[model samples]
Structures are given as structure tokens and as C-alpha cells.
Target: MSNKLSIVVVEPDRERAILIVDSLRAAGDFDVSVISEVTGLARHVSSRDPDVVLVDLTSPSRDILEELTLASGPLDRPVAMFVDRSDDSLTKAAIEAGVSAYVVDGLRADRIKPIMDAAIARFHMFHRMRLELETTKRALEERKVIDRAKGLLMKARGLDEEAAYALLRKTAMDQGRKVVDVAEALVTAAGLLS
Candidate 1:
């Protein structure tokens, strides 16, 4: 991937958006787009396919936060929201909505780069955790399928667990498929037979 990051600044105020864009430009060479209107925000942000999103709101409402949740897609990219002030409930809502970074009373030109960096890093950390979780869940599901297949073989062919697994492995090797795939097929066939 290129080093240049495509950023989308969602600021209703034109002047503030310009300042944020200028700060980003000063930090590094970045592809930045500004969304001044909050209407159809999801479409605007998605169209840009930005690497990161920076939202500046004077005082965010629940409705706006919901809109931002749809627009930011916290899992897809890092989103840093800057607000003048906030309460516990609003802060909780923002984090729950998948905002990577929620800054309160800290939107200065000098602080922009560091905040952006932190948001990206935090997002990556969460992304890695999510991927690892998905991998673990998939492995567990595959193990269950394999065990079911083994049980079916043990009952039908009077084979031991090891022998049943060997059969599955052999079938997978012969077919140029994964052991899990063969096991899944066996399990599906057994289910259909029942």
C-alpha cells in the first residue's frame, strides 16, 4: 500500500474543516476530502473510501452519533471524533458506536497528528484482536465438525478415532482439499442420511 493516507474530515463548519485539512496537510502528504454537510454522510464517506475519518462536532447529539456510526464504520477504518465538551453518556455512546478515538476539548492544530497516529494504532490493535477471535472461532467450529465426522465413521465402519481421522486426512489429500473440508463433507452427508 502507498504511504499516502486518504482522510475524510467530517466537519459541518467550513472554517473548522479547512483548519483540520490544513493541519493534516502540514503533518504529511495525505489525500484528504472534507464533508461539510451531515446529510447523507455515510454515502459521502464511503465514496471517498478514506483510510481515516476525523469528525469535529461542537456538541454531538445521539442522532448525530448514530449517523456517524453508520458513516465511520469503526471496523473498516480509524475514526477520531473531536468535540468541545462531552459527558459520560456521550463518551460511552461514541466508544460503543466504534469510534477509535474520542477526544474532548483537545482539538488543536498541533495535537492533530499525534491523535491521528494514536487512533490508527488503536484501530489496528482492535482489528488484529477481531481477526484472531474469528480465526479461533472458525477453528473451534472445524474441530466440532471433524469430531462429528469421526463419530459417524466410528459408528459406521467400527474405526477408532485415530483411524477415522486418518481416513479423513487421506480423503482430503487425494482430493487436494483441506482436512476440515473433507470432514465437513462427511458430516453433511451423515446429516442428510439421518
Candidate 2:
């Protein structure tokens, strides 16, 4: 497949929308699409599978923000929202709704490229952070399960902590399973018996 970045622009104003589109076209080798309608925007975005989405609005309502969230958050596409004016509360709401970039009264042709670049970069950074958080959480949960299993083994067999861990390791090696798998199995069995 071509390595060009795909971009989708949702601009209600036809005249101003062209300005943004033209700017993006000038930025680099970008496959750009502009949608004049706001209804079913998420579905359209899903079908397009754009790398980034730019939403230009006079003033965004809650429903519009929600639609943008659904379009960008679930689809995992970076989005930049340009508005004529915005308050602190709305800005906070936009971020909460998963808007990567919320620009207020700052829609210049020259700035579109950088804003889009920043949006994409921020989205990727956040995505990586989220993945790391999930992995850390899983590791922590597995550690807790293993600790619980080790405690059970120590109490039942009158073994020391190290001996309990060794026994669990030995069982896991013999069964050709992960330590977490064996630990989970033991914990489940212990729970069932009690």
C-alpha cells in the first residue's frame, strides 16, 4: 500500500473547508477527503479509515463533541478541532471526549499542517502510554495472583515462601504452562474447595 497519510476534514462551511483542504494538500503527499455533513460522521470515518480527522466548526455543541469522540476515540484516529471561540469548560469537555487537539480562533492555512502533525503525534504518544498502562496493570494482577497462590502453598504444605515459589515453578514447568496460568489454576481450585 502507499505510505501516504490519509486525512478527513469535516467542515460545515464549503468555502472555509476548501481552505483547510487546500492547505493539507500542500503539506505533503496526503489523501484527503472533506465531508460537509455532520450526521453519521463516525460511520463515514470508519469506512474511510483516515489517519487523521480535522473538524472545523463555528461553535461545537455537546452532541457534535460526542460525535467527534465516537469517530476518533473508537476508531483510534487523531483529530484536530478548530473553532471560532471556546471557553475553558468546553475545552475540558473536548479533551475528556478524546479530542487530540482543540484549537480556538486559530484556523490559519499555514498552521493546519503543524496542528495536524501535532494531533497525530499526540495521539500516538497517548496510545503508547495507554498500552503501557494496560500491560503494567496486567503484570500487577498476575503478581497478586502468584503471591496469593504462594501463600496458599505455604499455609497448606508448611513450606517457606521461597520453597512455595519453587514448587509452583516446578509444577508450571512440568505442565509446560506459564507461571501465571498455574497460579490462576491453583487459586481457582483453592477457592472452589473452600
Go through the candidates in order and give each one's C-alpha lDDT. Answer: 0.63, 0.64
lDDT, candidate 1, 23-45, per-residue tens: 66766777878787767776677
C-alpha TM-score for every candidate: 0.49, 0.48
TM-score of 2: 0.48
- For model 1, the superposed segments whose C-alpha errors exceed 4 Å read 1-109
Worst 10 residues of 2 by lDDT: 97-106
User: Residue 20 CA error for candidate 2 (Å)?
Assistant: 18
- Which regions of candidate 2 deviate over 4 angstroms? 1-112
lDDT of each residue in 14-83, candidate 2, tens digit only: 7655766676566576777887776776667656766556653233632454454433355354444543
lDDT of 2: 0.64
